[model samples]
Target chain A: MRAAVYHGPRDVRVEDVPEPELDGPDDAIVRVTHTAVCGSDLWFYRGESDRDPGSTVGHEPMGIVEAVGEDVRSVAPGDRVFAPFKISCGSCEFCRTGLHTSCVESDGWGGDNGGAQGEKVRCPNADGTLVRVPDRYADDEDALRSLLPLTDVMGTGHHAIVSAGVDAGDTCVVVGDGAVGLCAVLAAHRRGASQIVAVGHHEDRLALAEEFGATDVVAERGEAAIDRVRELTGGGASHVAECVGAASSMEAAVEVCRPGGTVGYVGVPHGLDGGLDLFSFFGDNVTLRGGVAPVRAYAEELMADVLQGTLDPAPVFTKTVDLEHIEDGYRAMDEREAIKVLVEV
Target chain B: MRAAVYHGPRDVRVEDVPEPELDGPDDAIVRVTHTAVCGSDLWFYRGESDRDPGSTVGHEPMGIVEAVGEDVRSVAPGDRVFAPFKISCGSCEFCRTGLHTSCVESDGWGGDNGGAQGEKVRCPNADGTLVRVPDRYADDEDALRSLLPLTDVMGTGHHAIVSAGVDAGDTCVVVGDGAVGLCAVLAAHRRGASQIVAVGHHEDRLALAEEFGATDVVAERGEAAIDRVRELTGGGASHVAECVGAASSMEAAVEVCRPGGTVGYVGVPHGLDGGLDLFSFFGDNVTLRGGVAPVRAYAEELMADVLQGTLDPAPVFTKTVDLEHIEDGYRAMDEREAIKVLVEV
Candidate 1:
C-alpha cells in the first residue's frame, strides 16, 4: 500500500507502507477514494504539531469498505462510508453524552505512523466510526467532497453553531476564513442566522465566504474587525464562531458578541494565553463553548444534506491532485495558494 | 445624610454627605435600614479597584422607601424593599432576556457617586429595582439577612447554578469560600444537587459551606483540588460554580468539570493575566457562563424561600456592626476575620 508520510517540516513523500489489517473483530478496512488536506494537517506538515515523523497524515477520507470483521454489524464490504477524524468506541460514557472527541477509547488515526492518507486504512470500532453514504449519490464528486468535510470540518462548524445556540434570525459573526470558518457561515445560514459576517483579510477566501452565505465580509483584523462586525450587525453579533485558535481571534470573537450572546470557538488554540475579563463577561453575560468537533454525531445528517444538494461544501476545495502529488497538495495549502487541496486515490 | 466614603485605599470615613433627592420621575429616596459590606466594596477600599476617590461605596442594601417619585408605582412610601445592587429599567432588550445586569440602562447602586451605604440612597428606576419584602417576615432578622444577601451575593450564587444548568441529582462544585460561594452551595442544595464539593482553604468558610449542604470540602488548592473533586464525584463534577474571580479559581472550575459539564463563574476577575485554555476548551466541550448577578429577577422567589424557612443563607453573616463602625466591617472581611459583615444603619 502507498501512503503520504511526513518526513520533516515541509517534507512529505509518497512511499510504500504496510497495508492495514483487521486486528480486532470490530475493525474494517477502507480503500481510500478521496481525501482532503486540512488546516490541522499543516500543524504537523509544517513541524508545528508534536506529531512524530512517518505518521499517517490524513483523517478526512471517503471510500468503499474493502473488508469488515465479524463483529461489524452496520457496514459491510463494498459499502461507501465516511470516517470521522477521532474514532470512538460508541459505547463509552463520553460518547453517550455526545462528547466523542473526549471519548476515553477514541484514537487519532494518524499518530506516529501514516494512517488515513494511505490507499488502504483500517478503522477500529467500525460500528461507531463509519457513516454509510447514501446509494444515490455515492460516486458524485461534489457530493463526495461535501461528505468528506462532514467527517470533520462541516460537522465541527455545525457543532459551533449548535453549541452557541444560534437561532433563526440571529446575527452571527465568523472569525477566520479557513475551510471551517466558511463552513460555519453555511451552518449559521442553515440555522436561520439572518445576518452573517465573515472577518478575514484574504480577498479570495472572503469571496468564497460570501458565496457560502456570509451577508457581509470585513477585511479588517483584530479590534477593527470587531468594530466592522458591530457596524454590520447593528450593535454586535448575537453569536460569534471563532475558527482561528489564535489569541487575537478569540479576543475579537468575545469582544464583538452582544450581551447575553455566546462565542463558539472551534479552532484548536495554539499557545493561547490571556485572562478573560470576568467583569466585562459578567457585565455582558457572554458564554464561551469550544472543543474538538463532534463529527460522528453529525456525519449521517450532514451526508444527507450533501446528497440532497441542500449544501455545497466542495467549493472550499480549491485544487484536486492525484495521490502521487500529495506532497504538492500539502505545499499548496501551506503556501496559501489553495484553500483546501483534495487528493484522489 | 451620613455615608461611607472611600478617601483612599484602606481609608473609609463615615462623613456627612447631602441627602439623595429624586433625579428622575422613577427615582426614590430609600433610608437604608440594613446595608452589607461586600467583598467587592473591599476591592475599592483596598485600592484594588479603579474607583475614584471620595466615592461612596456599598451595593447591597435592604431599606424602607422613605420617598417615591410620581412614576414609582410598585412600592409606596414606608414599604420595606430590597433593591438589587444593579438598577435597571425593566423594558430593555437585556432585561427582557432576563439578563438585568447587562441592561442598557442598568447602573450599580454603589460606585463613584452612587452609595447605598449612606443613610439615604437615591435608587434610580425604583419600580424596577425594588422588591417588596413579605410583611409576615418583616421583623425576622434571619430572613432579612438572607434577603439582604439575595440583593447581590445569594443572587449571584443562584445565577451561577442556573447558568450552569444544575439539575436535580447532578454533582456540583463551588469554587471559592466567599459569601457568594457559600451561598452557591446553598443554592445548589436547594436546586437538588445530590453531591456538592466546596473547594476552599479556609476552615471556617468550609465549615459554613458544609452547613449550607456541601457534601464535601476540599481544602486543597489548584490541581490537587481538581483531583479531590474528581475523586469524590467518581469522575468530574457535572456543574461548577466559580465564585472566586481569580484566574486560578476559574481554571480549577474548568479543570474539575466533566466533558459535557458547565462552569458558571460569578467572581469578578481581579488582576490576572491570560489563563484559560481555549484550544483544550473545545476538546473538553465545557460551557463557561458568568457575569454580574441578576439579583432583581430572582429576588422574589429567593425571598419567598427565605420567608418559608426552606432556605436560610444568613448563617454566612459572621459579624454585625453599627453603621458608624462600617470601616471596621470592611477590615474584618479584608483580614478574613469574617465570612460576611452586616452593618446596621
Candidate 2:
C-alpha cells in the first residue's frame, strides 16, 4: 500500500508502506477510492501544528470495503462504503446518543488505523463507522464526488447549523467561507432558513457561498461585517454558524446573533490562549453549541439526499489529483490555490 | 411610601420616599404586596458589585395595580399582577421573540421606578412586563405565595432547565442550593426528568431539593461533586443547570455534562475577572446555554401551574418580614439565616 506520510513542514510524501492488518474483530479494510485534504490538515502542513515525521495523514475516506473482520456484520467485502473522520464503537453511550466524536473507543483515521489518504487503510469499529453506498449509485462518479464530503465537511456544516437550531423562516448567519461554512449555507437552506448571510474575506468563496444558497454575503471583516449582517437581518439572526474557531471570528458570530440566539461552532478551537470570553454570551443570552462533528451520525441522511440528487456539494472541490501526486493536493490547499483538492485514489 | 435603600456594605435602611408616578404612556403603578431578597442582592449587599449609595433595592415584585398610564391596556389599575425583574417593551424584536431581558427599552425596578421592596413601583413597560393573576386567585393567599417566586427564581430555574433541553426521562443535574438552584430542581421535576441530582452544600437545602424532586443529592463541592455526579449518572448527565454563576461552579456544571449535553446556566456570570475556559466545552461537545432568565416569558405558564396547585416554590421563602423590617430581612439573608426572605409590603 502507498500512503501519504509527513516528512516535515511542507513535505508530504506518497511512500510505499506495509498494508494495515485487522487488530480487532470489529475492524475492516477500506481501499481508498476518494479522499481529500482537510483544513485541519493544513495545521501540520504549515508547521503550525506538530506531527510525527512518519505519521500517515487524512481523515476523510470514501472507498470500497476490501475485507471485514469476524464481528463486522453490517458491512462485508466489496461493499462500496465510506467512514467518518472519527472511528467509534457505535454501542457506546456517546455514540448511541449521536455524539460519536466522544465515543469511548473513538480514534482518528491516522497512524495505526491507517490514514484515509492512503490507498488501503484499516478501519476499527467497522460496523459503527462504515456507511455502505447504495449499489445503484456506487459506480456513479459524480454521485461519489457529491457524497464524498458527507463523510466529513458536509456533515460538519450540517452539525453547525443544526446545533444552532436553525429552523424554517429563520435568518441564518454563517461566518466563514471555507468548505464547511459554505456547506452550512447549503444546510441552512435545506433546513428552510428564509435568509442566509455568508460572511468571509474571500471573494471567490463568498460567490460560492451565494451559489450554496446564501441570500446575503458580507465580505467585510470585524465590526463592519457585524454591522452589515445586523442591518441585513433587521436586528440580528437567531441562528449563527461559527465555522472559523478563532476567538475573533467566534466573537463576531456571537455579535451578529439576536439575543437568545445560538452560535453553532464546529471549527477546531485554536489560538485561544485563555479559552473564550464567555461573558458576552452570558450577557446576551446566546448559546454556543457544536464541536468536532459526529459525522457518522449524519452520514445516512446526507447520503440519501445526495443519492436523491437534491444535494450536491462537489462544487467545493476545485482541484483533483491521483494518489501518486497527493503532495500537490496538499500544496494547492496550503497555498489557497484550491478550495479543496479531491484525491482520486 | 417606604422602601429599602442601600446605605453601604451590610447596611440597608427602610426610609420614607415619595410615591411613584407614571412616567411613560406604557407605565403603571403597582402597590407592592410581596417581594423577595434574591441571592444576587447579596453581591451589592456585600459591596462586591458596585452600587450607588442610597439606591432603591430589590427586584421581584408581586402586587396590585394602583395606577395606570393612558396607554397601558392589558394591565390597568386594580388588577393583581406581578412583573419580571427586568422590564421590557413587549413589542420589540427581542421581546416579541420571548427574549424580554434584551428588550430595547428595558430597565429595572429601581431608581425612579421605585424598588420592588417599596410600597409602590412605577412600571415602564406594563403591558409587556406585567403578568396579571386571574381574579379567581388574586386574593388567595396560598396561591399568591406560590406565584411570587415565579417573578424571579422559579422562572429563572425554569429557564435553566428549558435551555438545557431537559425532556421526559432525562437525567438532570442541578448545581447550587440557592433559591434559583432549588427552583431548578423543581423545574426539572416538572419537565419530567426521571433522575434529578441536586449538588449543593447545605443539608437542609438539599432536603428541600429532595422535596422538590431531586432523586439524588451530592452534598460535596468541587471535583468531588463532579466525580459523584458522574458516577451517579453512569458518566454524566445530559441536562445540568448552573444556578450559581461562579467560574468554578459553571466549570463543574460543564464537567458533569456528558458529551453532546447542555449546561443551562442562569447564574449571572459574575466574578469572572478574565473570562472562561471554553476548551473543555469544545473537546467534549458540550453546549453552554441560558443567561439572565427571561422570567416574563415564563411567568404565565408558571403562574398557571401555581394557580392550579401543581407547583409551589413557596418553601424557598424560609422567613418573612414586613416592609419596616426589610433591613433585618437583608441581615438574616446575609448571615445565611434564611434561604430567602419574603418581604410583606
lDDT of 1 by residue, A155-251 (tens): 8888878877888998899988998898998899888898889898799999999999999999987677778788888888778898887777777
Q: Which stretches of candidate 1 lie over 4 Å from their true place?
A: A222-224, A275-280, B111-113, B135-140
Model 2 ranges off by over 4 Å: A7-11, A47-50, A135-139, A323-325, B16-18, B76-78, B134-142
DockQ per candidate = 0.67, 0.63
Instruction: Write model 2 residue lDDT over B1-345, tens digit each, in one string.
Output: 899999899888999888889887889999999998998999999999988988999999999998888888898788999988999998988888888899899899889999998999999989998999999989988888899999899999999999888999999999999999999999999989999999999999999999999999999878898999999999999899999999888889989998888999999887676577777898889999998899998888888788777899999999999999998888888988899999999
Local accuracy of candidate 2 as per-residue lDDT tens digits, A1-345? 899999899999999888998898989999999999998899999998899999999999999998889999999888999889999889988899899999999888888888989998899999999999998888999999999999888999999999899999988999999999999999999999999999999999999998989999999988999999999999889899999888899889999998888999999987776667877798779999998899899999988888988888999999999989988999999888898889998
Q: Model 1, residue B125: displacement in angstroms?
A: 1.9
Q: Write candidate 1's Cα lDDT for B1-345 as tens digits.
A: 789988898999899887778887898888898988989887887788777778888888788888888988998888888888889888888877788888788877764325888888888888888888967776777678877888888998999898888889988999999999999999999999999899999998999999999999999877788888999988888699989888778778888888878899888777555655454446688888877778888888888788888998888789999889998999999999988998899
- Model 2 chain A: ten consecutive residues of lowest lDDT: A270-279
**Candidate of highest lDDT:** 2
- Cα miss at A213, model 2 (Å)? 1.8
Error of 1 at B344 (Å): 0.6
